[model samples]
Each structure stands twice: as C-alpha cells, then as structure tokens.
Target: MSQCLNPDCLHSNPKGCQFCQKCGSKLRLVERYYAKSILGQGGFGRTFLAVDDFKPSKPPCVIKQFLPQAQGTATLEKAAQLFDQEAQRLELLGKHSQIPELLAYFTADNRQYLIQEFIEGDTLQ
Candidate 1:
C-alpha cells in the first residue's frame, strides 16, 4: 500500500498507484520514495516509512515531512528553521556509523521533506 502525505486526506492506496484514491495526492515523493506507513507524528511534523524506488534494492527509508502544528507566523517560521537545522544536523551526523545516514532532502508540493536511512527496531520515542 502507498500512504498519502496529505495531512487532510492521508488515505491508503494499493501498490502501483500513482496517486491517492481518496484525495488524488501523488503517492510518490521526489519521484522516488513511496511512503508505506506513518512512523510517528509530533508538533514539528510527521515521519513515514518509505521505500526508495530509485534504488535497485528499493531499500526502505524514513521520510520526514515538515508539517508544523504550531500556530502563528513566527511559530511557523521558527518551526521551519528548526526543521532545516535538523536536516543539516543529520547530514553532518550521518558521517558516523552510529547515526542513520541522510539520503535526500528537498521541498515538493510546497512541503519540505528529509529522507534518511531506515533503522529497524523500536524508535527512541
């Protein structure tokens, strides 16, 4: 199944679907990652379990969408700044074997996304 990233219509669609059945949102992000399920969500944004179709192995990855829950322009701007900082930090920290490697980060459909290597097992959360 492919999961829709739209916050208003996060519907699940069958595999191979190019777009969400419910909301018509594209199933793929950056023309590669297909979000299968949500891993977690918080005030900052949401994390999704995804697969990178661009890779030969179609390896699993984590996709972080910057969807701040805070209100007001200042709060939203601050949240966006923090999100960018988090991505920058991940890019640097990923050099270590202990930290999950950053795969890709970009903005699409007006939403910012950060893709990273997936680590199996329970999350620290």
Candidate 2:
C-alpha cells in the first residue's frame, strides 16, 4: 500500500499505484520516497515513516515535512527557518553513530522535505 503525501488527503492506495486514488496527488516523492504512515506531528510539521524505493532493499526512512502551522507571516517564517536549521544540524551531526544520518533534503510541490535514516525501537518521548 502507498500513503498519499497530500496533507489534506493522505488517502491509502493499493500497491503499484502511481497516484492517490482519492486525491490524485502523486504518491511518490522525487519519484523515490514513498510514505507509509505518519510517525508523529508537531508545531512545525509531521514526520512520516517512509521507504526509499530507489534502493533495491527499499529501506525504511523518515521524512520530515515542513508544514508550519503558525498564524502570522513573521511566525511562519521563523518556523520555516528553524526547520531548515534542523536539517542543517542533522547533516552535520549525522556522522555520529547515535545520530540518524541525513539522506536527502529538497523541495517538492513547493513543500520542503528532509529524508533521514530511520531508527527503530522505542522513542525517548
């Protein structure tokens, strides 16, 4: 199954589908990463459990969608800046064994996404 990346839709689609059945939005990001389900959501955006389909193994990964929910323009800009900062920090820190490695970061459909290594097991939160 494929999970739609559209925030408003997020409709589940059958395997081999290229677009969402309900919303018609493209299921694949960059024609590679496919989100399976939402992992968590916060003030800035949502983290999704995704897979890198470009790899032969189709390894699991995390996709961070920058969807700030701030009210004012200034607040939203700050939130976006913070999101980019986080991605930059992750790229630098990922070299450490404990930090999840940053895999890809780019903008798609006007939305910014940060794809990173998926860490299994329980979360500290």
Candidate 3:
C-alpha cells in the first residue's frame, strides 16, 4: 500500500498510484522514503510508517512531518527553528538504546520532515 503524505488527505492509496486519490498529492517523499500508512497525528505534527529504499531490507521508519498549528509567517519560522533544534537534540539522545536514531531531516515541497528508525513497541499513553 502507498500512503498519501499530504496533510489534507493522509490516507492509504493503491499500490501503483502516482498521486493521491483524495487530494491529488504526490505519493512519495525525498525520493527515498515511501510512506505506507499514517501512524498518528496531533496539532503540531503527523507521523508516518515509511520504508527506506537505500536499505537492502527496506527497513521501516517513522517520518515525522512538522505541521505547526499556529498561523502566520513568524510563527512558521519559529516552528521551523524549533524543529531544527529538536532534530539536533534527537541526534544526541539517539546514542542511548531507548531513543530512536535520527536518520534524516530535510525540507521539501515547502514542508519539513524528520526521518527516524521506527521503534516497534508500546507506549505509556
């Protein structure tokens, strides 16, 4: 299955679809990551289950798309800045076994994304 990365659609698409049926958005991201399903979402961001093409096993990953709830240019800029900082922090914290390793952080299609190793387990929530 192919997952629509568009925040508006955020649904699974047919395997061969080049574009999203719901929103007509592209079905891939960063040329390497192919999202398969949305894991979850909040007011601040959304997370996706994706596969890395570079890996021989096509390892699953978590693609965290930054979507700030606040409106306005200044707010968006601040959100981007904070997201960068968080990426840096994750890089450091990833050394510990408990934290997921940060794989990549980049911007495309006027949006920000943080790709990390998908840790399969339960959460307190």
Candidate with top TM-score is 1
User: For residues 1-125, could you state the per-residue lDDT of candidate 1 as single tens digits?
Assistant: 99999999989899899999999988989789999999999887899999999989999999999998889999988888988999899999999877899999899999999999998877634
Estimate the TM-score for candidate 1.
0.94
Ranking by lDDT: 1, 2, 3
The C-alpha lDDT values of all candidates are 0.92, 0.90, 0.88
User: What TM-score would every model get versus the actual structure?
Assistant: 0.94, 0.93, 0.89
Question: lDDT per residue, candidate 2, 1-125, as tens digits?
Answer: 88888989878888888989998898999999999889998877888999999999999999999998879989988887888899999999999878899999998998889999998866523
Output the better candidate (1/2) by TM-score: 1
The global Cα lDDT (0 to 1) of model 3 is 0.88
RMSD of each: 2.2, 2.1, 2.4
After TM-score superposition, the amount by which residue 7's alpha carbon in candidate 3 deviates from its true location, in angstroms, is 1.2
| Backbone-clash count (model 3) | 0
Superpose all Cα atoms of candidate 2 onto the true structure and report the RMSD in Å to 1 decimal: 2.1
